[model samples]
Target: MAFLGFESKVFMAPMAGITDAPWRTILAACGAGNLISEMAAINAIQRKNPKSWQIANVKDEPYPVVVQLVGNNPELFADAAKLVTDLGAYSIDINMGCPVKKIVNNHAGSALMCDLPLAAQIIEATIKATPLKVSVKFRKGWDNEHINAVEFAKMCENSGASYITVHGRTRAQGYAGVADWNIIGEVKSAVKIPVVGNGDIDSPQKAEQMLQQYEVDGVMLGRAMLGNPWLLHRTHHYLQTGEILSEPNASQIRQMLLKHLHLLVNYYGEHSGMAISRKHIGWYVKSMYDAKRFREQYTKLNTLSAAQDLINEYFLRIEA
Candidate 1:
């Protein structure tokens, strides 16, 4: 459970295009025990793709950073793992849980699940390439007809992976149906290494349930943490104590949103930062009254000051 020096059991999953430096910084501040960098392609990193390099950046984060790499080639995986290790990654995570079409088509991501030998090869190569702890994140199977998570997890453990994380859905499910926590439990029973259960853990209660029901060493949060980093802290607290903490109030939510915007702007310049902040703003207010109208108006605004004014106005109206 202490892989890569992480003492806390709650982790933030590596979400492509979402779990960037700014967001990871926010989540770490909110008490995430460990953070995974957005998934970067091995080929892109080897080619020195600027955006891929940017995606692997984990500067200024307080917690341990795990750089997740996706690829089919063992040599490329080793090269990419070394790159991230030089960048100060605390550990390297192999991506076999991503079900995106482009990634799978390239023989990466969940596609690796169908070819267990190659998956083990990539894990072994990466582990040999760096002293950093190497881990693997994978799904239950290629589909419901092919549930191989237990077999695949044992292979990964045998190939020198320090830990394993299982997302309770098959590749065909693709975020559509409920995650089968039973499969996660099965994998946990099969592996001696730490197993982290992922998928459908959107709340503190569900997180606690995953630990109890599945008997996992930890839980990983993905979409659930979007615009709601407080989930990490709350889940941690709930697991430590039997009491549930109150949700963030209106003022607290507004303040956090503003802080997120500033961090985005500081990391990315105003033009691109404000463009991305719109989506985050939408996530933050999705449950608010008149949210649809507010999102429509908010997305059209161009300047940071204008966006700030509108957020203030919207919250004032909510208070009224």
Candidate 2:
């Protein structure tokens, strides 16, 4: 069963400050399956925050977009679900596995994992509130000793969640250590619903291995996709045909970086856009010839043209 009618099995896990509209649109163009948006707070949506509304702005998006919501309040989540539905969200994903301190401090995010009753309420309320498909993203558990992914998977299924994505780390791990695909397999086994595995599937080979090893329904790529947009397409293609695709060469990288810069600038304006593109520029040129100094010079430039000139010259010098 395709979650939200997504035919492709490869998905993009939303990264805050990274999976904005421009980025999501780019990923859709790159041939990712259903795109999960950066998680926004249900409280902010209920309060009518412009930032929250901006995050839910998928009304005009050409690709299917799942607007993820995070909160401890089931009522607010119900309201936010309807609002996002009005904003054209293709589905909803509850953020039950965010391990950030501030979030858990407020009894939201992964904190909900420690309180399965409330988590169930949030999920069931969200599913009942929207005609759109509902999904949950969670971890192995709050900690190692409290490992309860299998139990949580059963809870999600019983609460009527249409899909689930299991990131193979606990709240305590917070992205460190190797992700346990074994837990993902366990979750897949514990529930009959579609289970998508996340975490540590960095390369095409690893992504394929996750599918083959964990027996998951799909794979979601997160940090690995930073600056490596082609990964989604390459991984998807490799899974479909078993043929590895060529990595983008120097010229191709240059072209992609330049296009990404323009997209950022157009969406966020020059000053902020140039500032944001610095990290992306670094990611794109990671480990390339003289990239350290190149990144330093790029950061110092305030104007888009200066940044553009730097990117072009640096890439050209590397090619020469």
List runs of model 2 lying over 4 Å from the truth. 1-4
Question: lDDT by residue for model 1 over 247-298, one digit each (tens)?
Answer: 9888888989998998888888888889989889889888989999999998
Compared with the true structure, model 2 gives a TM-score of 0.97
Model 2, 66-102: lDDT tens digits are 8999999999999999999999998899999999999
- Report how far residue 185 has shifted in candidate 1, in Å: 0.6
lDDT of each structure? 0.88, 0.89
Can you list the residue pairs that collide in candidate 2? none
Top model number, lDDT: 2
- The TM-scores of all predictions, comma-separated, are 0.97, 0.97
In candidate 1, position 107 carries an lDDT of: 90
Model 2 accuracy (lDDT, Cα): 0.89
By TM-score, the best candidate is 2
